[model samples]
Target: MSTPMWKRVIARILEALLAIVFLAPLVWVIICSFSPQAGSAQSDGWGINNYLTLFNYQAGLPTYLFNSIVVSLIAVVFSVVVCTLAGYSFSRFEYPGRNLGFMVTLSILMVPYASLLIPMMVWFKDIGLNDTLLGVGLVITLFQLPMSTFIMRNAFNAVPKDMEEAAMVDGCNSFQALVKILMPVVKPSMVTVGLLAFLEAWNNFMIPLYLSSSAKSTLPLAMVNMRQQTMGVIDYGATEAGVVILLIPCAILFLVLQKYYVKGFMAGAVKG
Candidate 1:
């Protein structure tokens, strides 16, 4: 280990190269998003005209952004709450058909997501959820459940049984112990699950496509609609602007919670 100076240097160089490779496209998109292009609403040399165009399209940027945020937040809240309880149940309680139930839940992952949308669309319509933001969010939450449940289950399992026993010995009830003790211990996994759910719902195109109308479209659907010109030509500039808008929240969220996300996976891997 003391004689690895050259190896470290090589590793650093390789890391730099890989970073460039990954970041190059993002940088290019950001630059191109500002560059002047034909059919841009603003004829100024270089500015935010592309963004302006996107902002003014269809229901407008604010509406689409609001829809996306609403859907993503709905998915996050539902996934975290349901998965937390489920994970706790699976880890702490012994029940009939527990393993079989878990397996059945995970088996949903094997089905193609798109294939179920049409059938679910009909169900959603009958239930008064079709063409609604809540409907799309629920769909995203359903798809996210399996993996989120797995993560939370492993996180709960990785905790010590003695912790729960200690809490009970101190007179805390099961719910109180879970809320006051075990939940805090597994916060990273919760954050990871929430973040994953947010990203999935934020960028989902197909769910909204099948279950929603134009008024309920999220950012992804808006972006696709923005791409069409009067003559069927694609508006690349406006499209890139949409990419920048979409990338910002995801990038910031990931950067802020990256440590927790990695720790969450590590916690699950350590014991499971």
Candidate 2:
């Protein structure tokens, strides 16, 4: 079922074309971030000033970066721990209404986050979780749990039942078997879940804005305020630089965890 030579050539051409189309904007942004306003780079003087200005700003890019990292890490930790436990239970244990319970959790994934905002805000206020980083992190964690749990469940479920049975034969209890054997098999899922949770939390805007007060703002909200306060002349240069800054950690994270991400997906998808 190999493609004809002409078809293979066409496919390759289409792929190259699509790659350029997709990468064009990213290349343009990188160019602009280094481009100067009036010289040669302006007169051959386009340097990393925009990136420098991003650091030069009052709040300092580092502070915003730290905030994003802290909030995302908190949310990611909650997501991994809670979702792993819930996913393991769903995948490995039997109990009354287990299917119904899973269905309920998965149901939340279908609903958009926008739909939950108002009710969540009210709940946050009632709990005194409002106007705080913890509140925003918790909100992001809540939204992330259902989908990540589902992913982890599928991942753990894909572990062959024989492995668990073998462990039991060797005197391993259920908890011991999970920790000693199954958890390693599902490590890829853990990386994937962690990356996804971190990205979602890092990029979240509405929850942070709604939950934070003037004294505290996550990077996304801060970016918005920075734009507004600058009036019409939004520093596309600086903004682009900031966006590059925002993207740095996400890039590093994916690069570091991409192998696990791929492994987890393949394991889940190919489960027999």
Best by lDDT: 1
Which clashing pairs does model 2 show?
A: 39-42, 39-43, 40-43, 40-44, 40-45, 41-44, 41-45, 41-46
- Residue-level lDDT of model 1, residues 95-155, one tens digit each, is 9999999999899999999999999999988999999989899999999989999999999
Q: After superposition, how far is residue 18 of candidate 1 from its true place, in Å?
A: 1.3
Relative to the true structure, candidate 2 reaches a TM of 0.88
Candidate 2 segments whose C-alpha is farther than 4 A from its true place: 1-4, 38-45, 56-58, 229-231, 270-272
Prediction 1 global C-alpha lDDT: 0.92
Which candidate has the highest TM-score of all? Answer: 1
- State the displacement of the C-alpha of residue 22, model 2, in Å, after optimal TM-score superposition: 2.0
